[model samples]
Target: MMEVKSKGQQVSRREEILDKAARLFKQKGYVATTMREIAEQVGMEAASMYNHIRGKEELLEEICARVAETYVNQMNEIESSDLSPIHKLQALIRSHISITTKNIHWISVANNEWRHLPDSSLKSFKKARDTYEDRLAEIIRSGIDCQEVADVHVSITLYTILSSLRWIETWYKPNKSYNARDLEENIVNILMNGLKKSG
Candidate 1:
């Protein structure tokens, strides 16, 4: 029990460091943010911060890689499910909204500051992101084939949904009138039905 408790505390501190770094990275661009600023945000000395983290680049890489991996893993699961294309699409949208809202700062940094990551990490992040987008496009293609989705440009539709979903962190306010569930439903309804009215 003592060993478990000690490990839990270590994990907690590591998470705290990442959280503070994410906020700083989002507020100030990743290049502008420093290890000292992150340490200051978490009320720790710069030297002490190193005990939990290697540096700001590692923090950015960690957040970017973690969030990217999560989206890919979620997509993998959704793709394998026996659900219809439309249902799978809805699930993807809903999951995107939910995760982004919960980790707004992390997602913001990952989306915007991922370029600052080391070359190897940058390549991996982009590959994961592209894979996720391609899987989403596959779902759209499946929908088109099954006549569930209208015959729209698959790439355009995928781009529209992915871009809009990614930008949710820019405008979504958790305690405001529009909550996650509302955002998910509204996005699905709007994207599925589109701007044109029925006759």
Candidate 2:
């Protein structure tokens, strides 16, 4: 008979591996963080990791997928709400920026480490990521039509908004002074007002 572990134990082990790998990736980067090193961090043999995942690349994909999937689902939920286009746009952007800060490493993994994956993995990852971006772009397009967001190139505006927030991962640190909500407010203000305050 097969041995059975409780679901909580399985989930905890998975989270342990994911969390340790993420920290290693963030600290040592993708190229430098070897599977052996990651395994050792969690007191397992490097080969034993294959029991949980195919390879290091898949782990990176999983980390990125978690954030991307969360954003896509959040976008879908926001879109279904009864709010006006302006409110929807504002609320979604706020939530999106907050999420970026919450899972800041996703930005680095998405932009930096994802390219090192195999072609098949890359394709799957790109599809999920692009679909998420397209949803955001669709919302931006809606905002433009409704005059909630300014009249600008839809792709450019969306990219600009997202790129600015994604760049935060490089320098952002969770602290008492500023936080995800503060970043969201700043982004909304920049979208609404120019650098020069009106008299």
Candidate 3:
């Protein structure tokens, strides 16, 4: 029982360290953040941090990998669903917003600091990102074929939507008046209106 409790506390401490590292990485770029700073934020001795995590790169890899996995899994589910092309796009938008708002710090770090990941982790992150984008593009292509979306360039449409969504972390705040649901609805309405085929 004592051993289990010790293990649980270690896991909890590791999570706290990761959370602090993510916040610092979001505020200060990953390249700018140091392992000692992360330890200080988590109220741990600098030398003791290694008991919980390997190093700063490990923190970054975990953050990026978790966020990438979330997006890829959500995209897979959205793509496989029986929803219409337009509806699939809407669901995709909602899922993106939901994940972003819920994991704001992690998402921010993952988006802006992932380029600093070690080479192998960098490659894995890019592959997952590409898979997500390709699946989204396929949905857009389906929409165009069904005449539910305008005949715009698929790459342009995909990038436009993704770029817009990606920028939300820059201005969005949980304590702000503009809540996630409102943001989601407004974004969905705006982007959908632009993509929908007109008479």
Candidate 4:
């Protein structure tokens, strides 16, 4: 028999493991972080780790999936909320950067350690990742459609934004100079308004 609680409680324990695993994977990477390391991070034993997940690959899948899923959900909801494509793009990019920064550890694994997963999980993860990028591209394309983004090279724009967000995990440190949220907003503004003088 399976036990169920409110969604929060039901998701809490697993979320704990995923969160800790994200931290470990980010710090040590997938090759270095053992299941036991994640288990210990979440206050569980090696054997007990199996109760929550099948194996490391599955854990990887969950970490990556949660990130992609969160981004997609945020984008979808915002798109449906009637925001202009330009505002939606800003909001989406801002949210994407915020979430990726908050989950830097998992984001690293999702980006760098992706090759370690078995075939099936890798495909699933790619699907989610592509969907996430496509969502952003859609917004950019919409902006072009409405003449907000101009006829710039849309693919390059999308790639630049995605790559910038992903690469920040390597250098981003919380400090007085800037935080992740501030950095995200700054990038958003720069992308919308180029460096060249408008006049």
Best by TM-score: 3
* Candidate 4 to truth, TM: 0.83
Off by over 4 Å in 3: 1-11
Candidate 2 structure quality by residue, lDDT tens digits, 150-190: 66787877777777666676787878588766877888888
Report residue 96 deviation for candidate 1 (angstroms). Answer: 0.8
Give candidate 1's whole-model lDDT: 0.81
Ranking by TM-score: 3, 1, 4, 2
* Clash count per candidate: 0, 0, 0, 0
Query: Candidate 3 lDDT (Cα, whole model)?
Result: 0.87
Task: State the lDDT of candidate 1 residue by residue for 7-58, as single tens digits.
Answer: 3435687888888888888998898888888888888899998898888888
TM-score of 1: 0.90
Which lDDT tens digits does candidate 3 get at residues 99-141?
8887888889988998899999999999999888888999999
Candidate 4 residue-pair clash tally: 0
lDDT of 4 by residue, 1-199 (tens): 0111113535677777877877788788888989988888888898987887888778787776666667667777888978888888777777777766666676677778788878987888788778877777887888878777767777898787777676677788788699876897788888767511243
RMSD of 4: 4.7
Which stretch of 10 consecutive residues in model 1 shows the poorest summed lDDT? 1-10
RMSD (Cα, Å) for all candidates, in order, is: 4.7, 5.9, 4.9, 4.7
Best by lDDT: 3
TM of each candidate vs. truth: 0.90, 0.81, 0.92, 0.83
Give candidate 2's TM-score: 0.81
* True-vs-predicted CA distance for residue 144, candidate 4, Å: 1.8
